[model samples]
Target chain A: MSQPRNREQTEQRILAAVGEVLAREGFTGIGVNAIAKQAGVDKVLIYRYFGGLPALLAVWGRSGQFWPRVEDLIAEQPDVLTLPPPERLTRFFSHFIDALRRRPLTLEVLAAELVARNELTAVLEEERERWGQAVATLLGGDDAALWQDHIGATTVLIAGVQYLLLRARKIRRFGAYDLHSDASWDALKASIAAYAQATLVRPEPAGHARQDKP
Target chain B: MSQPRNREQTEQRILAAVGEVLAREGFTGIGVNAIAKQAGVDKVLIYRYFGGLPALLAVWGRSGQFWPRVEDLIAEQPDVLTLPPPERLTRFFSHFIDALRRRPLTLEVLAAELVARNELTAVLEEERERWGQAVATLLGGDDAALWQDHIGATTVLIAGVQYLLLRARKIRRFGAYDLHSDASWDALKASIAAYAQATLVRPEPAGHARQDKP
Candidate 1:
């Protein structure tokens, strides 16, 4: 193989190894030596290519399972934007949940962010902002206050879903819902979708007193 | 101090020391020797009295700041149960946030639960069930299905608040909300409260169609 091709392959191997280790052991297992061992590459190569573990993990998040699949969803369903605000949000929530569920590493990385601050957090924040902008646009510039409120609500909703799933991995069951079971998962998604749809509609400005509307 | 009295004093000192260590160095700083050193107690006593660090931490959670204060709030405001569900929930959210803020150690303990499983998590889980029962009572036992939906929604709301505040300790800001500031925190609490109230009144049953009401 050519010299440059070998370097590129080495970098790819390191990134892939990071994902595998992240899946198995979460953020705790993503040390420099572990990545090198998993990749079967020299330790020097990790530093030479990625600079450090934080940067490497961030790269893995950006290029690995989560974002790539999200991008494809957006590409495959370009007309998702044309749907009503609530419908668009429901679709987005479903896609986002599926992505996180498939790539458990994403959820682990998010859990790690709660305890520690690193370069990876910035990437997470930026990706969150991208989704925020997408959701914000769904309101279509009607009532500024309501738009802002829904944006904040959306942030909480996303964080809530992620946190519940993270805990579900450990505790298995909370309240009457069984996180380990498929039926409960489907119920969770449906309930959140309905809730997201309802939150965006602001018939009344302040009290949400219109909440009893049939 | 007499022998039994001395033993009681040592246990109290050890529990207080755990809080100090949790606040100062976080869960990573917590260990058998470190607690003994901080409390000026013997390592043998910690094992003898509390059985281990996990049990000690669990004792601290049950006796120390957060849950104890919350129980007082419930006790002090006997009228809280009689008020409308929305009012009761808002009050509960406010008190819960205050308890968390006042006892930053509780937040640290919760963050620790994310990475490690110990006796502390079981205490946390039990506390969660207590609150869940309280919220369920407010549903008035009218519709079983609606009750379950609200239970799930309430779980998400609590998790969202906890996750945001946990992240605030590290990242300081998320989206447009500043988790560290009073104004932003109040805004978050109010938004969640309103969202929670809107969720319970299931006028349309399936779609939460009343959500758009003023």
Candidate 2:
């Protein structure tokens, strides 16, 4: 027998194998045997280390591959919560769409969470709550009644974007937007930004100080 | 062998079985043998009659159960196309949401179409195209550039509503919207109507005659 891998190495190998399966077989190919074979580890290791497939998926989601990673981003920016509401929202959704575009696996995981009522559904809920808190902070401390409506509408828009992009993976043009073209992508992002501005831009009274609370 | 039923009866039985499976086991439970067993018919009959599972789903989708049957609705109200675009869109989406709320199976089927690249996806595309054309007529014929944006945005909204309702079947609340309560439901519908009106409403020249044609 060959030398055994350390715990960190084994975890990394398993996670990398999950990405490999996602790359080769798309969403439908995710399975325990497939992941183990790809990782060159025994299938029992997944149960021992990660508990099960759902936990494994949840761990993979929090890994560097998937995002909104809002906490980490905020840790970097530190004042992202203090920008003007509209600008803050624009940055938030732009980062969101960027992360979504960069990580197809995240979308697949989200799609699975949407469909299946499993352990990962709770993970999705917790992650969404975190994102909601971030947006609420940007929307003026959650006391504004408008934030509720904003969250509802923005959630719909986000879900819609996720569905459209997921479908765009197969068919390019759905309506006015072309998913494959850069111009169309820019137009889509611009439309989203405009939506953010339209929905979240609240006029301040003249000479009102900008709220930059830490 | 017993006396054979006519083609219509067999088809109806198969279709009814599909709904039974959908109602009892949800979207993922649908398969050839299960449907055939539920219908009390040979599995070969599925291929012989409906061509296959996807074709069966497509046929079931176009059946009386699903919503936004615009052709049928138009036949009932010959002048619906002549209404103000905003009012027409509000009514259209209200009806759309009502249909969605009434028919959970339709949402399940739609969710399946969203996730998997199957025959149902093509069916969904064709159905969406038909619905888009109907909406285009309401938005003032096919030439108006605004209709494209309207369609794209409305598509996103419709997809979002579908996703939300499907999730609401399990989790009651995600963000600020409560999907189960009547007050929340009214608020949700109001928001959708507002969205529809916001997206479709446009100023026209005074004395502009509303377009109406077969």
Candidate 3:
């Protein structure tokens, strides 16, 4: 019993450490040594449990940390099929953007994963699939209205923060995108929600699949 | 008279050389020797005409090979006061994007310029007055909208291709973001236009300013 608890504690510590390092230094700054040190876990145990930065991040990247906090706003799982398109779509998108705001660390890791271009790509791809499912589910729980374009607009809207960060790296203009400010967060939530509402309500036919092979 | 025309030809030749080198190699890859060789201009004259890459790029970066195409779309000398609210805004944005599509080289240079940071940022800062005026004209043709969120969004949207390229750099799983593909370009143009329309129309009553800077 004690062993299980100890193992859980160790894993949590490691994850917390990884989160801190990623939030602070981002992907370029994160390493096995940094994670272990921050977690206060033995470096070897980190290897044993998480494999490496890639594996550790795979779990982090693929998990529910990226999902919005819908439970707080909605009483229960939305019967997406039956709900009026506007409220259902708006609320769901609001929840989605809210979720990203709730987990800025997830945003950080996702961007880092995006740029890492390494073994993490598979994990990121899986996360992308999960995100699509999440968005599709929000679209109608299978009754998606204009799902394809809604998804494209959603991708761009949600991607705003990550995109800003990339600009920050190139220009080294920190604070250009302050993800933490409450007003800033509200504005982000508003911008995406506005975009999503505009996008999901319309009746655009499904166009061709993206020419992008990947 | 022939000598003056020859001098004009010499200046044009050197500027053309800058654009070519930037297209073939990224910002990191450009230097003095290559520019002279490519331009078929004497190495010494490069210094004489433009001083160096910094000066040459400073000039070229402003109204050179790429932007003129982009600028042609918007009425450069518009009577700002006469233009209507969203029409001026969306038209300016659409035209700017159209211009970006007209010449592939601008996106390439802008992409490299954005990522390269230091020197380019200084150049961008120098051009801020001109950029601001042009962007402000697009926002509403009025001075009020210039200070708000719309300009930032527009600038970022203008910078969207760079964001796409940077993300592509990470995945390494696909081809380039073709600015010319009708579907892709149309979608991109629509999104930006839609965003501009939404941002500028029925904008908040004049005096509101975001309290927090992000």
Candidate 4:
């Protein structure tokens, strides 16, 4: 019992150390030696317990620290699906923006992925894809009208949200909004609401629609 | 006269070499020695001609190679401003995407900017800001009703396009669309047009609006 408990404790410490090193120095600083030093353990133990760095990262990726888990996002709004599509989208983006903003380590890895692709990013990418598919199913399975018809538009909104949040890590301003300010984010939320409202709601028949193009 | 011409030619060669090295090895590979060697010139000439790497990069940034020039986008569509706001936006994005996709070097730098910011990115940032301002002005001077009210949506669209394009360098797909596929890009463009049409053309007054949230 003592041996198993001590091993569990050491694994937890090593995992915690990955987060610390990641936050302090970004992905470039991650290594077995670094993690062992930060964990206050022998480097050999890491190989014995986790197999190697890729496996260690894989475990960390599954630990819900890399990206927001679907369960957590849905947990925040118990009746999310019951809401109308537009409101559901607004809530989804609002929760997503909030979730990503809170994870500085995740943001760092996202930034690193832009330039470098290796085992680390590969593991994170797989994790993100899993989360992405889960969220897609939650938002209305891919076969649903909202997703099937408007996937392109949906992609734009989602990719846009990601870019802006990632951009915030480096620059404070993108266009008229100051990314560092909460007020700006609030306005962004409102815009998301407006966009969702506009997108999800089908426009009235062409004859009665306002003709701005002419 | 020949001496001055020879000096001017040397400067051109050094500048061209910057683009070559950048395309080959990215921002990290750029150096006085590398650029000089690529140009078939002495390393001292790079300093004497451009005052060092930062200055050389600044010159390159201004050369219209690092990002699209507003003139080029407008040149592709001379009647851009006369069109309706939605159509104008569609044309602008279409041209913008086409321009960016053509410049692999610009794309490389954009990816690099996400991870590192230094003299190279700083110089490019300033240049991009200059171009961004010009674009804003061209798209309605930032004071028009379209820009004043819908900047958030506009940011989402523009940034989404950028993110997707930058993403294509690494991953072939984003969402349901393959980033490398022209058809996928066409779908994105149509989505942009749809989003622009929805955003720029105000929906009917609240009484007549479709209520999706019940």
Chain A vs native chain A, TM-score per candidate? 0.75, 0.73, 0.60, 0.82
Q: Cα lDDT of model 3 overall?
A: 0.55
lDDT of residue B165 for candidate 2: 73
TM-score of 4: 0.84
Write the residue-wise lDDT of candidate 2 on B65-163 in tens digits.
Answer: 464566554454567667766566666666666667887877776666656766665666777776756655765553366555555456666667777
Misplaced by over 4 Å in model 4 are: A1-14, A31-33, A41-59, A141-143, A203-214, B1-13, B31-56, B141-143, B203-214
Q: Assess candidate 3 and give its TM-score to the true structure.
A: 0.54
The CAPRI classification for model 3 reads as incorrect
Model 2 ranges off by over 4 Å: A1-8, A48-55, A58-65, A71-84, A141-149, A196-214, B1-8, B47-65, B71-85, B140-153, B192-214
Q: Which lDDT values do the candidates have, in the order given? A: 0.71, 0.68, 0.55, 0.78
**What is the per-residue lDDT of model 3 for residues A66-154, given as tens digits with 9 covering 90 to 100?**
54434443546545457756566556645654555556565555555433345655766655555555455655555554555444434
Q: Which lDDT value does model 1 have at B181?
A: 92
lDDT of 4 by residue, B14-126 (tens): 88999999988876688888998888888888788888888888787767565888889879668677676777788888888999999888888887777666667777776
Question: Order of all candidates by lDDT, from best down to worst?
Answer: 4, 1, 2, 3
Per-model fnat list = 0.51, 0.31, 0.13, 0.55
**TM-scores, each model vs. reference:** 0.80, 0.78, 0.54, 0.84
- For candidate 2, the docking band is acceptable
C-alpha lDDT (0 to 100) for residue A161 of candidate 4: 83
Error of 1 at A108 (Å): 0.7
Candidate 3 C-alpha error for residue B66, in Å: 9.7
Per-residue lDDT for B72 in model 3? 61
Error of 3 at A1 (Å): 24
